[model samples]
Target: MFKILFQLLAISAAFVLTAPVNNSTTGISKLNSQQYNVVPFGHVDLDDYLSNSTTFANHTYLSAPGSQNGLERRGSVHACQGSFTKKLCITGSNAANLVGALCHSISVALEIQSGNHNCADTGVHSVSDQTQGTVYYKYKTTGKGCTTTAEPGTIEGALHKFIKEKNQDKICDFVCIRLTHGGNWSGYVGLGTSQDAVKYSRCDHEIGSWSACVNGDKGDR
Candidate 1:
């Protein structure tokens, strides 16, 4: 009887040790779900854009095209900033890679805005084709409220200082600038591969132009 009882207890201990842990409590869930891989841009606080009174209904998840392959799964997070009335989207093949890419991109944007014109210029004109990867600014407000001098050289110096101070990589593949009617501004800087960067840059430029025109602001070429 004693031997049998001891065996049963040992089996129970093995089961307890081998059972899967509850990730909900540990906060380290497996990254198997498609939704888990998609996230908001790092610099922007998406929650701040959402309303607490509402049920947070302005977000969606969509599968990325060409992610049919099992190993290369891709997903995107589409969200709207209710307060600003702006839409933001982010996509990635993997969550970790996407976060890293966003960090690098936002860092570049901040560096450029800090008066680093040279770095911003290089990123704006890095692609081989002039038509491709062209970076430009768009004014959001009308009537030319600000007529600052075009200090490209001074801006370049500031950008260089930003890179040195921030320890950022010199190479950039994509850049975007957004100006709001309230004088608030934002940018997206991406360090994707040459091909991906050019694509994103072109798209951002077009979108920026459209937004500026719609808001009665001049588009910077």
Candidate 2:
């Protein structure tokens, strides 16, 4: 369909605009739907945000939970054999936004086998919320700046069609966000770890399976 073609062109353009990372997805695997929790998310315009072009691909998410269509979301996890890797896979809408996808940026997801290492993302996913806490989604929009907890909503504020599936066929990680900022933008990937003295705020509000906490997921298998 025309829509699909446009998306392909866009993805291709994304690669052309930025230098490609390893993205060699050889060992990639995704958890089943029961492992990752559904989340709410929205389009965060990192318009000219970063100081350079960055892509958070080719990384493995070792600690995700089962996802559920809590906030009216959809999709499920499966075998990511055809994906960019060989691990369990995910495919769902947002049930808790940053609690689900963004966690990858802040060391929320652990690296396989390396029980001591939490995952880190260079993009917005987990960085924004992990750094700003659970309030960024609403606070940023309201100009309040993470003053309180995030209210219940859909992915992209429950608006729909904002958080597009970045990688699925070529990558097991179904969500991705690529950006080319020029330093003028003022956002940084939060380097927080789940093992910190503090919890992942309200990550306890599991929308599905993947533990919302930084050090939460421990493999249900």
Best by lDDT: 1
For model 2, the stretches where C-alpha displacement exceeds 4 angstroms are 1-45, 48-83, 94-163, 169-221
Candidate 2 lDDT over 58-110, as tens digits, reads 22233322222231111111101111222322222332443343332222221
Top candidate on TM-score is 1
> How does model 1 fare in lDDT?
0.25
Score candidate 2 by TM-score against the native: 0.20
Estimate, for each residue in 1-221, the C-alpha lDDT of model 1 and write its tens digit.
99999997875442221122222324333333332122111111111221112221222222222122221111111111111111221222222232332333333334444443231322322211121221211111112322213232222222222222221222232222222111233233322223233322332222321111100000110
TM-score of each: 0.25, 0.20
lDDT of each: 0.25, 0.22
Q: What are the runs in model 1 whose C-alpha is more than 4 Å off? A: 1-95, 108-112, 115-120, 124-181, 184-205, 208-221
